[model samples]
Target chain A: TQLLEQSPQFLSIQEGENLTVYCNSSSVFSSLQWYRQEPGEGPVLLVTVVTGGEVKKLKRLTFQFGDARKDSSLHITAAQPGDTGLYLCAGAGGSEKLVFGKGMKLTVNP
Target chain B: EPEVTQTPSHQVTQMGQEVILRCVPISNHLYFYWYRQILGQKVEFLVSFYNNEISEKSEIFDDQFSVERPDGSNFTLKIRSTKLEDSAMYFCASSVRGGRGTGELFFGEGSRLTVL
Candidate 1:
């Protein structure tokens, strides 16, 4: 079984602060995706990283895939209240199943 | 943007009762999947359906759980006998391709199931 572990399970920061979350795994993945889920709602896709050492940016959020394809990281710059949510990283291999990390709950206070 | 939709946002059933959850995936997508997340737990894959048949399934999908694409637009999951442990939020997802390694999934708002 494949497992993805995320660090900093809970983070509380004031607006304008920056934070980074990490996701690590023992197995290699062909692709990794980041999702943000609000309370009482399903997760919303943030970005998908395919190539090793790839980086993608969406507004204030930046996602990076590790060179070995076994890990990834998400960084938020100048966070705002709207950035508060549960961030999850899912790794996919050849099979259709996606292995997801436990997720990081982030709260940005204004 | 297209999105997956599920009906009866919430359902409550008694143990041993049968329940069916309905989902309408994005119109042009070809692959569909069912996932569940217990309260305070990580999301788990239940099953994946493609070309009108189950392509893959997890150990959690036991004899009581089944999936069907009855028509072009609707996908359904039927639980023959609900158990108290079955209580969770069920999400329906769809992708344009069958390979999760290359495709991104679009998910529904989810159906909350509570088995008493």
Candidate 2:
């Protein structure tokens, strides 16, 4: 089974802090997606990186897909309270199913 | 802002009782999926449906689980007998034709199922 492992399961930081969450896997994936979820809600799509070494930015958030297609990362710059949420990474291979990470719970205090 | 919609935001059922979770995928999307997330756990893929049939399913989708697209817009997941372990947040997702490698899935708000 393909597994996505995320580091720093929980993070708490003050406003304006910059942080990065990592998603790593042993198996290669065709594409990777990043999502942010709030309490009692489903995950909201943030970005999708298909090419290896590709980078995409959404406002203050930057997403990177590893060259090997086995890992990804999400970086937030000058985080605000609104950026606080659970960050998840999902990967899809030849199979139709997508494998999700355990998620990184982020808390930004203003 | 087209998005997937799920019905009965919260459902409470007893063990051995059957429950049906409903979802309305975005119009024009071709692929539909069901995923579940246990408390403090990662989201687990249950099944994937395409062209009115199941294209793929995970081990979590056993005999107790079934999926159906009864109408053009409505997709449902039925659990023959819910167990306490079935309590989780169930999310419905859909994607357009060129979806797989592109990684664009629109998800519903999710249905919280509680089994007692």
DockQ list for all candidates:
0.72, 0.73
**Which runs in model 1 stand beyond 4 Å of their true positions?**
none
lDDT of candidate 1 over B1-116, digit per residue (tens): 88999976999999999999999999999999999999999999999999889999999999999999988999999999999999999999999975564758888999999999
Model 1: lDDT equals 0.93
iRMSD, per candidate, in listed order: 1.2, 1.5
Which parts of model 2 are misplaced by more than 4 Å? none
How high is each candidate's TM-score? 0.98, 0.98
Quantify all predictions' global Cα lDDT against the true fold: 0.93, 0.93
With a 3 Å backbone cut-off (N, CA, C), the pairs that clash in candidate 2 are none
lDDT of 2 by residue, B14-59 (tens): 9999999999999999999999999888999899999999998988
Steric clash count of candidate 1: 0
- Residue B64 lDDT, candidate 1, scale 0-100: 97
